[model samples]
Target: MNVVEMLQEEKVVAVLRRLPSETFLDVVRALAEGGVRAIEVTMDAPDGAELIRRTREVLGDRVLLGAGTVFTREQMQAAKEAGATFFVSPHLDSDLMHAAREWGVPMVPGVLTPTEVAAALRLGAEAVKIFPGSLVGPGYLRDLRGPFKDLKAMVTGGVNEDNARAFLDAGAVAVGVGSSLFPRTDLEARDFASITKRAERLVRAVRG
Candidate 1:
């Protein structure tokens, strides 16, 4: 399936930021073990391009690999070249979105307002990520859906097991979880088991 179809099927996107280059594969394995079928490797991570290439090689088709925190057309191209099937940005950038579309890669551009969402759709974005989702809460998502019922939105930031389902119920097509699902302290301590457990909990929350 294509990137957007894969994301819709998975219903959850596990976002990794600043993962240790050495342990990136191990982390991917742990997340996969916990039933996370999609992963986003943020550009901020060390050697992100090489990491994405390696991740694509290692994971193969078992997971849908995506690049996140993309802010420029160059970054988007790098990600696409590195074998990322999808591109996710923290904001709506016309250049970035258009590049992804032209390359036939799914793009999820971040937006905080109706105007931005409309602009992203107009630019041919596959989906729009509602960033810093914690600040606006599910109530904001519900309100947005009222007017843009066909809009595909993925809630990101400050999302945890407790609120994951709420966002989906609030009309989010999927949820992007970061530190809450992959805590830095836990990862630094090499607590893969804890991360696995947290991911399982989130899976249950979203599935329910």
Candidate 2:
């Protein structure tokens, strides 16, 4: 399936940011077992490109692996080489959007206002990421749909099991869960089981 279809089917993208490289795959495995079909490893993570490569090698095509927090062409190139099928950014950048189009990689750039959302679409982005979803809440997403009814957005930042379905109901195709899906404490303690349970709850919440 295409990236957008993958996102629509999963309804959740487990955002991994600066996680320990050693156990990253283990975490991904747990998430998959819990029914998370889409995973995004932030570009800011240590050796993020290598992490994507390893994930593809180990997990194969069982999950939709993407690169998040992308900003520069170099990062995009590295991620593409590492087998990332799609990219996401926390903010909109015209150049980045253009690059993604030229390289034929699906990119979702973050936007919060009508202007940013319009700009992202004009710049050729197929989708947009509504960042800091907690700040504006699902109501804001509903409001955006009023003007951009066809908007394909993934709400990220501060997304959790309680609000995942709310965002989808508000017009988001999917939601990106970070700490809620992969809490620092759990990762530090190697609590993969807890992470898996969180993933299960989140997936159920969204799918319900």
Candidate 3:
């Protein structure tokens, strides 16, 4: 499905960062069982390329794989070859935005203010990701609604069950959950079921 369709349908993006290689497949499976399909595997991870490739091969179209923390053209290219059709970064770089457009890859560049949001839109970004969103809180998103009511926003950072719904209610089209969804304890214990339960709870909180 397209990014817009995926966002509207799933309303959540589980950000997997530097996840253990051994349990990567199981992690994805757990997330899927809870009805979360959009997954962003950080490119900066130790074995990102292999993970991306394997995720694509194993999940097929069952999940929408994205390359996150992607900043350079080389990184984007590597991710593309590894089966990531979409890209996400921590900052809004005009060049990176243009590069993604040229590559025909949907890139969600991060933004912290209205000016950056407008710049991203002009650069042809399909959507803008609000980084460190937890620090800014739901009010920040609510404030952006006036000038960017028509745009789609993804809140990444500091999102948990406590505030996932608040972010979505405020204006975020989708919320990206990292450590909150995949706790280190559960991962270490190979508690895939717990991961699935967490994902289910988060999904329900936002989309219910």
Best by lDDT: 2
Error of 2 at 75 (Å): 0.4
Please give each candidate's TM-score.
0.95, 0.97, 0.97
**Model 3 misplacement above 4 A:** none
In candidate 3, what are the lDDT values of residues 1-208, reduced to their tens digit?
Answer: 6786687678899899999899999999999999899999998976887899999999998988899998789999999999997999999998888888888889999999999999999998878899999789999999998878887889999999899999888988898999999888999899999999999998889889
Models ranked on lDDT? 2, 3, 1
- Which residue pairs clash within candidate 1? none
Per-prediction CA RMSD (Å): 1.3, 1.0, 1.0
Ranking by TM-score: 2, 3, 1
lDDT of 1: 0.86
Off by over 4 Å in 2: none
Tens-place lDDT digits, model 1, residues 136-168 = 999999999998988789999998888989999
How many pairs collide in each candidate, listed in order?
Answer: 0, 0, 0
For candidate 1, the TM-score is 0.95
